[model samples]
Target: MVRLKWRYRKRLRKKYGRLIWKVKNRKGRKGFFKSTVHRYPRRNYRILVANEYIAAHLAKSLGLPVARVIQAHVRGPRGRIKRGLISMQAKGGQVIPWKKAKKKLLKKPHKYVKQAKKLARLVAFDAWILNPDRSDRNLILHKKKSGKKYKWYGIDHGISLFGNPTKWNLRRAKKKFSCKKAYKFCLHSGDKKKQRIPRGLKRFTRDNRKQLGKMVKKIQAMPKGKLKKAIRRVPKGLLTKAEKKFIQKVLLCRHKHLKKALKRVSKHFA
Candidate 1:
């Protein structure tokens, strides 16, 4: 329900609806504009916005905790209006980046048993979507005041789906995708020297393995029609008919091969 403005060199020009921040380049160039916000509209911004919207819906269908996204109109610097997305901030808790939360949570596995299982499913979800940017910064940890537990949420999926957001086509979609980085944050036992696994793997326990398997099954069981319906929800002009069809085809293919793809990364969580 909030309208954002596009600022450029102290003047507004319509491109796509993403929040614009003015920052000086490393070389100290003045009036240089750069976007620190993810999923904001810009040149060829439609694809980025579409990627976030589609990913959010698809995640919800999988029963994952994701931020709700909606498209809204925003005015550019010159009073030009364009479509953009607004992600509703999560409430009932203060959200913290995974990077900070891992230190305290990882040391006490018994305290966060449920969170461990959710993290496993999140890793699998990222693999399914072919999102390689699932770094610690992208995943957030929300701690509710009522309990000592923390809930995890995934955000900033602009680079997902077709991999490279701006330069995607059916041809690129046909190429094989890897899930190595997607599982990079999964829970696992670390090497002898470290005596500890990666941050994402710290809470993983053998008990969660069955739950992870169930999550995979849930993903594979997702109906193709439902996936298409989710894609169709994206407003027109954000994506063309061919683009939508291409995404649907890619998702179907990935879902079909998800089990095999996940197998390669199973060791991380095991």
Candidate 2:
């Protein structure tokens, strides 16, 4: 039973990002701010700030609709960490309740048809990064007041990639990749009888495999230099050089195996 220590370069005065104004309350607002402001060394999950930046870049590069994320500096309990992710809160979008929505759509299957393509692309993006936290809360259903149309925007990617609270330099975070983990819709669970599929993944039907495939190809096509530049923008003390390289390797490997992995997940819908 060993504890992982997160290293922070508190004395480094060089700031890597711009200052973000503090918002009053994010609960009901469209754009929300995610900060490790008060979290010091002990319980702080600073890696999330970096992961959010990386995830947002990946999502946008593949043409997925996501909240715009920017680098922001936050003053916290221990010291100020320049590497923070501030997601621009979007307005006029209603959050979807997965359980009720699922039950309602299952009863009247036609309701699912409209969103099938959008959901498929989202699923493809999530599947690429091994996102285990695409709960109903992360999706914002933007309804147009005048028109009878809406689009679902995916957000909250801090817990994606290596899973929640991805502590720096954790061995488990760098575990050997397997197709079993790669193709998994929900990271920690299997295709067992009682296991529940991720809420965001439910709309990804077998019929939308082509959409999924298309999205995956876009992800794979992302320039390596762009990926490196995004990763390099992370706060100085958050991750070591080796850890950044490891993260890149993991993503490249995932992109390579995405199609095969996606097929496995798609089988469940069939």
Candidate 3:
């Protein structure tokens, strides 16, 4: 795979996207970032972009496992990385291709299933916290030391903070443990009596609930001025009255709630 030079074109990419290119790196091999997809006019593109940036930053601050964003530019103001622009590039880590994940995770239990559940529990907390736009495809499965474990890294937040207004609908994602591998895990395990729930999943979800609640509590614990100052660092335009109203409708506005937030987080304890 070779890197392609970025050119400022009036139109978006073609059937396969012009800016898109496959990149081979030391750790992972993936396609180059598509500069045009986000450029096309759509639903609150600027706000959505800013929201993605905000989500990534906020997730990192709260210590959630997320992808490291790389800001790239073909051309910019005075030829530097455009201040408000971001683009994806290949990075280290075995980012599992979604196409093959279901087959692998489902065809019996070819290992890595436990790790998948653990990763799901961890990321599910992220989903619960920000209630961000997440899908099975965004998760990456990779092997680990101490007997082939698995880890999940969150990706694609552009649709998160500013995507659909229905993100905070907690009940939308049913509590039924239905990860692709969950079924396989049950099938392959010796215990055929109903799908077995792993101890690790319970512990992982419990810890995630604790962590997010802690993060919310920490924010609530902070002095008002400091909290305001912190929120100010987020991109300005991303904060919209409609968005705020939507968040409030879903009850995820920026406010101080130590015990309440903790209770809210644990309520979805799966």
**Which residue segments of model 2 deviate by more than 4 Å?**
1-29, 33-44, 70-86, 92-116, 166-168, 175-204
- lDDT digits (tens) for residues 11-31 of candidate 1: 322222334322222343322
What would the TM-score be for candidate 1 when compared with the true structure? 0.68
lDDT for residue 236 in candidate 1, whole number 0-100? 73
Q: Over the stretch 72-164, how does candidate 2's per-residue lDDT look in tens digits?
A: 444433653444555665565444434345555444333543454756687777777767557665665555455344455677776566455
How well is each residue in 1-270 modelled by candidate 3, as lDDT tens digits?
Answer: 323244333222332112332332333433333332333423344444444565565555545666655434444224432222333432444546333465545332225554343343343334323433354445545544453644555655544433332232223322322223221211111222221122233335564454445555544444545433324444566465444444333213333323343354345445
Segments of candidate 3 deviating more than 4 angstroms: 1-44, 73-93, 97-132, 143-147, 164-270
Clashes of each: 6, 4, 0
RMSD of each: 9.5, 9.4, 12.2
Q: For each candidate, what is the lDDT?
A: 0.57, 0.57, 0.40
- How do the candidates rank by lDDT, highest first? 1, 2, 3
lDDT of 2 at 12: 21
TM-score leader: 1
